[model samples]
Target chain A: MSNDIIDGILEAIRLLFTFDRELWGIIEVSFRVSLTSTFLAALVALPIGSFIGLREFRGKKTLSNLINTFMGFPPVVMGLIIYLLLSRSGPLGSLGLLYSTSAMIFAQFFLAVPIITGTAKAAIESVDPTLKETILSLGASERQLWWELIKDSKKSIIAGFLVAFGQAISEVGAVMIVGGNIRWETRTFTTSIVLNTRMGEFGMAIALGVLLISIAFIVNYGLTRLQARGG
Target chain B: MNLLKVSNLYKEYYKEDKSSINVLSGINFSINKGECFVIIGPNGSGKTTLLRILGLLEPPTKGQILYYNEDLCNISRYKKVQYRRKFSFVRQKPIVRNTSVFNNIAYGLRVRGMKWEEYINDVNDIIKLVDLKGLEKKNARSLSGGEMQRVAIAMNFVFSPDLYLLDEVSANLDPMNVKLLDDFITKIKQDKEKTIIMSTHDPLEAIKFGDRIAVLNNGQITQLGTPNEIFTAPKDEFTALFVGYENILSGTAEMDLKSGLTIIKINNLTIVASEQVEGEVKVCIRPESIGISKNPPSNVSYRNNFKGNIEDIRDLGNTCHLIINCQSERFLATITKLSLNNLELAINSEIFINFKATDVKIL
Candidate 1:
């Protein structure tokens, strides 16, 4: 067993260095879906999160609790919910988006929104109250106040986005159920690893796993550098 | 003409349990342009709340604040922002942006859309004024507390607003920074176009900086007058103790037909005051006004003199506070370090305490 594992690792390294087209194609599909979902999710989540964080209104606590509950939502459960929504004879089925990249993006966007919103809300809430009063006393307009808050909490906001991106890129259960792991269309690093392992292609699975970890490390390192520079 | 008038101002905070706490009530005062008004109060006295209301950051629960005859409480949000631009407020704790010191100081100007070229000279001048010249490029969050306060002051000073509201801006500052802030405020006080309203618990600061002082206690303004009047004649017992009057005694007074002085007798000591009052009264005498000497002078004009034993001596850094016990009555006398040493005063030593009749205030 040890000798087999060593052979599989050596083959994975060789395949990675040789720029295997199928492997890179799977990586591209994974990034395209995750990045699209993360970007769209941020656009919707950031403003709502900041508003909920800064303002006190009726039922705010209940809304905040609901968002926090959704942060821990299971990926497979979410996939099932999206699958029903996009399936034929369902309410949203007229769009015919099932088993496609868009369906996978939709599932991942749902998975990432609550995570981003919850983290961003916490980040904005952590800003010093004195800073808010000081800005207001300086006669900050509504637009200027919002701009200052965003600038002040930019590091945490970026960290929130990175967290959502990490969750989206590594998620497999939802995409597998929603996208059906279609060849060359919705095949991602996570789903391909499972598929290759099931087919006894240990070398390919190991290569995908190593590539996934490397991508996570690179993204996290870049974001950490950005946060440090901001500080 | 009054620049700002606050009438019947009141503020109450409600808790989650539906209980209400009255923080300030029935507050009424007006400030003139180019005058420095100081509010001296103890902790939890709603000084900051009052300052916030005047700064237009918080609205009173029930009252109206008029600025040049315009009701501020009824102004639109846009107009409120515009009115706030005419004044600057420095909070108790220095709050700076997590950016360069120069950018933090230039935030007010930048928010108003002033070009960098237009404010660069002014910002640099204020940087020098607050003694933050070398740290302009440093991150503001990395500075010490005093340095951060200087940055906060410089930020407000650069705006040169018509009214400046400060809330205990010198609370935690070191002596050097305190003097720097005092000097900056003194220079601003000389500018006739500017008005200032500040709050402090320090009586010396109130006396040194205020053209008019308001004594606030328990959410009420007990007395409002010039610094000399507040110091010389506090209206109540709380104000008397707050203003550093050490000897507060209840006595009965009657006019002396011969000398035209009110003679107050308290605990076997007869006190002659310049004021003419009858019946029961409270008298206050400042510690510094009493003269302490080793030997009684022969030809001096001091009227109130008593021979007492020095019960205690407190060293107050450049001044000595000597407690004299005269026939069961204790009087505190503050003398300079020079006088303290020249007289060789010590505990249990005999001393003569003297003060003029005019120094004793009958309240």
Candidate 2:
């Protein structure tokens, strides 16, 4: 068993060096879907999060509780919801998004939005209340206050964006049901790992696993460094 | 018209469960233009609440705040913004933006649509005014606490707001910073026709800077007058204690109608006050004005002098409070700790306490 594990590791390293076109296709698809979904989610979440953070209103606690609950949503449950929504007989069937890259993007967007919104709200809320009061007392308009909050919390907002991106890129279940693990198109690194392992291609599976981990490490390291330096 | 008149202002803070706490109850006062009014009070006396309401940062629950003959309670939101910019609030915990010192001071002007050149001249003058030269480009957060407070004042005062509302602006400041602020405020008062209203717990600061003094206690203004008036004649027991009237000796007053004087005899100790206050009087003597000596001074004409033994010696750094036990009375004399050490006074040593008759106020 030890020899088998050593041989598998050696083969994975060799495959990593070889840079197979099929593996590159999986990586490209993952990047394309994850980037699109993260951008779209951040675009929608940041303003809404800041709006929610700066205002006190009725039902605010309920809204915050619901958003927090969504943060811990089960990946498989999210997959099931997307599958039901995009299937042939589903409500969104007429759009023909089922088993497509766009369907995978939509699933990833759903997975990422709650994380982005929750973190962004916490970041904006963490800024000093006196800073807000000082700005208002200095005659800042409503629009100016919004922009000032975003400026003041730029580092934490970027941290929120990176967190959402990480969650999107690493998510498996939602992407699986929606992408269908198509060989050349929808096969992300995680989806390819499952597909290749089931087909008894252990070498490719382990190679994709290593690559997935390396990507996650690089992204997290970059973000954390940015955060520490107050970018 | 008074620059600001508050009639029965009240503020109630409600908790998340909707139960209310009354922070300010029916606070009322008025300040005329260019008057430096000081509010002296203890902690939690609603001084900050009154300042907030006057600055238009917090709305009063039930009353009218009229500024310049305009009822601020009914002002429209847009007009409120315009009016708020005309009043500046500088807090003790200086709230500066996490930006360069120059930017922090220029923020008000920048918000008011001033050009960069206009900001340049104005910021320079303010930095000069606050004596914060060579720190124009430094991050405000990196500055010392005193420097941060100076920048906050410069920021607020740069716009020449008609009213400068300082909320304990000298609290916890070092002596050097306190002196700097005192000089800066004095200069502001000298140059600008701005009305300055500040709250301070330090009686010395109030006595030094205030043109008019208001004593606030338990959310109510107990007395408002000149510093001398408040010091010479505090309305109530609390005000008297707050204004450094530490010695409150109760005794029976024997009025000498022929000489227009009242003599109080407590135990075997007799102290004469110049005023003809009738029976059942309490004589208040300020500790600073009382003298302490190991031996009695030569034939001084001051009518209030007591020979006693030192009961206790409290060395409070700058000053020492010596509790003296007279034959039938007790008195406190606040002398410098240096004087106590130089005199080599001990707790059980005999001493003489002397003050002029004019310094003793019989209430």
Candidate 3:
């Protein structure tokens, strides 16, 4: 068993060094789906989060609590919901996006939106109250006030974005259910790892696992550097 | 003409449970153009709230705030923004941005759409004015408390607003910073076109900085007058105590037919006051106004003199506060440290305490 593990490791390293085409394609698809979803999620979440964080309204607490609840939503349950929505007999069946990259992007976007919103809201809320007062006292216009507030909390907002990207990149159940893990078109690093492992392709499975972890590491490192620069 | 007039101003803060707290009530004051109006009050006395309302940062629950003849509350949003640019407020605790001191000080000018090249000299001059010249490029957040306050003042001063509302801006500063701030205020006061309305709990600050001082206590202006009037003759007991009048003696006063002075009898001592009054009266005399001499000098102009033994001597840095027990009536007297040493005063030592009848204010 130890020899098998050692040989599998060696084979994985060889495959990685050789830049296996099929494996890199899966990785590329994973990044494409995750990056697109993260971008789409930020577009919706940043403003919503800022509004929720900065403004006081009648139902703000209820809305904040609802977002917090959504942040903890189960991935598999979200996948099931997306699967039902994209199924042939479902309401959006005419769009024919089922088992497509767009469907996978949609699934991941759903997973990431709440994460980004919750984090960004928390980030903006943590800003010093006196900073707001000081900015207002300085005769900052409405637009200038919002811009300064966002800039003041930029570090946390960037961290929130990184968190959303991390969630999207690592998410498996939602994308697998929506994308159907088609070989070259829709297959991702996580789903392909599962497939290789199931098919006794241990070398390829280990190689993809290492690649996934490396990607996560690189992304987190980059985010930490950005946060440090902001600090 | 009055630069800002606030009439019947009231502010109420409502809690989440629907309970409300009246922070300021019936607050009325009009600041004249180019006059330094200082509001003196203790903590939670609505000094900050009043200033915030005057700064146009918050609206009064009920009142009219008029700039010249125009009511501020009735103005449109664009007009309000335009009017807000006319004044600058420096809060009690200096708020610094997480950026360079230069950027922090330049924020007001930048927000007003002034280009860097146009306002850079002005910003640099303000930096020097606040004595933060060398640290302009340093991070504002990394500075010491005094340095941050200088930055806060420079930030406000860079705009050179027509009206300045400062809320205890020097409350937390060191002596050097306080002096620097006082100098800045004096320099600004020289500009006859500028109007300043500041608040402080310090009696010395009020006396030094105010053209007219407003004593605020419990959300109301207790007394509004020149600093000399407030300090020398506070209208009420609260104002007297707040202005550092340590000896607040209550007694029954009656007009002395022969002397033409009011004689107030308290405990075992008969005190003479300038005001001719009858019935119950509260008289206050400042500790510094009382004379402490080892020997009773003859033919002094002071109307009230008493023989007392030193009850307690408190060494207060540059001065000593001697508690004189004159025939069971205790009186506080502040004397110079040199005098304290020269007299070699100790507990139970007999001393002569004298104060003028005019110094005794009957409230």
Per-model C-alpha RMSD: 10.8, 11.5, 11.3
> CA lDDT of each candidate?
0.88, 0.83, 0.86
Docking category of candidate 2? acceptable
Q: Which tens-of-lDDT digit does each residue in B205-320 have in candidate 3?
A: 77667789999999999999876567645678799789764566667999999989999999789999988899865677888899988898699999999999998887769987
i-RMSD per candidate, Å = 1.1, 1.9, 1.3
**Top DockQ model:** 1
lDDT of 2 by residue, B6-108 (tens): 8988888899999998878887888888889999999999899888888877788889988888999888767888887888888878777878999999988
Candidate 3 per-residue C-alpha lDDT over A1-231 given as tens digits, one digit per residue, 9 for 90 to 100: 787678779989999999989978988899999999999999999888887887778998899899999987887788889889889999887889999999999988988899899988898788898788788778887667777888888888888888888888887888889899999999998888888878878898899898889878987998879877834
Question: Per-residue lDDT for B152 in model 3?
Answer: 89
Q: What are the per-model DockQ values?
A: 0.51, 0.33, 0.46
Cα displacement (angstroms), candidate 2, residue B144, comes to: 2.2
lDDT (Cα, tens digit) per residue for candidate 1, span B1-363: 899999999999999999999899999999999999999999999999999999988788999998999999899878988888888999888889889999999989888789999999999999988888899999999999889989998888888889999999889889998888888888888898899999999887786678899999988999998775676456787997888644666679999999999999997999989999998666778888899878877888988988899988877699877778888777877889888888888899998889999998765
Candidate 2 chain B, run of 10 with poorest lDDT: B226-235
Regions of candidate 1 where Cα sits further than 4 Å from its true position? A1-11, A88-94, A219-230, B15-18, B246-363
Q: What is candidate 2's DockQ? A: 0.33
